[model samples]
Target: MICIRLFQWGIFVALSFVGCKSEPQNQDQKSIEKGIERIDVTEHYVSDSYHKRHDGFDWVAVSVKHHGDESLWVSVRSRADQKKPTCTYDTKAFRIDKNTYESTYDGKRIRFEFFPTSLTISTENPDDSNMLYFFCNGGATLAGHYGKIDGELDTQQIDLTTFSKVLNLQGIGFNVSSIEKDNKNTLTIFTFGLENRDYNETFTIEGQVVIDAEVEDLNSDGSPELFVYTQSVGSGSYGNIFAFSVNAKKSMSQVYFPPTSENPKINSGYRGHDAFTIVENTLSQRFPIYKEGDTNASPTGGTRQVSYTLVEGEAMRQLKVLDITEY
Candidate 1:
């Protein structure tokens, strides 16, 4: 049964890479509620620590399964060769306590075991496990012993105080699930199990991208019309994205992103993750209106009506598209 669950998530990852998987996640499970799914979990986990790697500042991230309320998982990364110089590194780990015991990852001896490859803890105890899962540099950058990059915690008092007071998500485990580049300068924030739930975290978001929106041409001219976007976050317009038109007074009118079929179908009606801006990255799926002939377009981008000539000298009216990448 557990293997089935992992397989399900694994398949989810696969589908995400190749567009998406439409199957809704199991909503009855308690752990599933942590973030609704792995994407939300990883988004919340990475938060500000996530680097889009635009100019080469990338984070080596990894994750482990929950061992029945296990707490504290750590990540270790180094550029030096581990086998030659005896493999010592500046390792980072998450902290542990009673209330957050089930919410965090414990990184004890995370450095010693998975160097040059990967490591898995071998201990039977959930809290004080003595095993480290290790792997070598491969597709997922497998590292040998002491070479794993488990999610680390901010042990500093300031991070602790601010995280506790602001996010109210202290001790909750973090990891990078699926990262996608948005627009031309931002990254979409998706966490493990963030759907259907609202997280109030101490986040720094610049240039708001509205979700659950609509677009209409009020001038009777065929264009990407007035943009009406929204800022909700749950069922019944809670986590809604809004995109609409500018009214007569130059204010935003009520319109939104078309509900095309290409998006990952959520249990709720119409909602999506925040849009991110990134350079040379894929635009996330959001704020679109569903209509015939536009069903197969890439889910996200600044696509709008354009008149262009094809090679055959045929005039075609279509929406322009952008690039797509896993990030």
Candidate 2:
């Protein structure tokens, strides 16, 4: 009877060992199946060649098919080349988060956000922060930056073409008036609360008409100064630039330009097609100067380079002038 009992125990132990071994085998099979499923899903959404190929300027071509609409396509080039890293993504349904769009694929995620003049893409991995991309709207260049954060990818895109038109300059408590040109060769500027409320000023340019106007912070102050470039109606390509600064009271005041007598070496009037540039709190302009009888279209003179520095008392005074030289 004891011998019979030992034989039964041996059989039971062998069966238990086989059962434990088979259980692990089943688990291994399931794990393999799951890995295969992940690969299939990844392949369905992204090309097999792109997998693990995240490196410099990774270009992503997103092809989106919307219901009852023609297919939409967009190509994004990573900004990694610019030291701003970003992650790449296959086109997928996205959710809006505040001013951003969020999307995910293959266990990775991406986010896009927009600023007044730029768009940014971010990811969770710090290493991925170096990736960056370009987004062009209506052929206008929209600069981008990259960073990393934890959470669902968030993205926001703006029709930059429209942002410039509908942007609320008034919502920020600053009001600007349109530049008006009068028949008398006078340019009138009106603004409210830029320096003082209900401020109006008229600038007289003898024979020039206002052609372009832009606002820039030449002094790198929080407030931007206005720059108006004028062209001679009679002499094509001949132009002059005028700059205005906002006073403490928000009043638009003209920034000073040195008189010809003060700097006899540099040309008196501004000319050429290139606008002036402000760098390191200094404004500079280099352009060809036509002789008395020469129009910009038929220049027959030397070029003048002038530089100015922002001096105390809210003025831009000539800092240095180079002798006029042949172009």
Give me the runs in candidate 2 sitting further than 4 Å from their true place. Answer: 1-183, 195-198, 204-206, 259-262, 268-280, 289-302, 313-327
Residue 133, candidate 2: C-alpha displacement in angstroms: 28
TM-score quality measure for candidate 1: 0.19
Clash count for each candidate, listed in order shown: 96, 24
Q: Give the per-residue lDDT digits (tens) of candidate 1, residues 249-269.
A: 222223333243243432122
Q: Please name the candidate that would achieve the greatest TM-score relative to the true structure.
A: 2
The lDDT values for all models are: 0.23, 0.35
Q: Which 10 consecutive positions of candidate 1 have the poorest summed lDDT?
A: 1-10
RMSD of each: 20.7, 25.5
lDDT tens digits by residue: candidate 2, 125-182: 5454323221222221212232212221112210001000001122112222222233
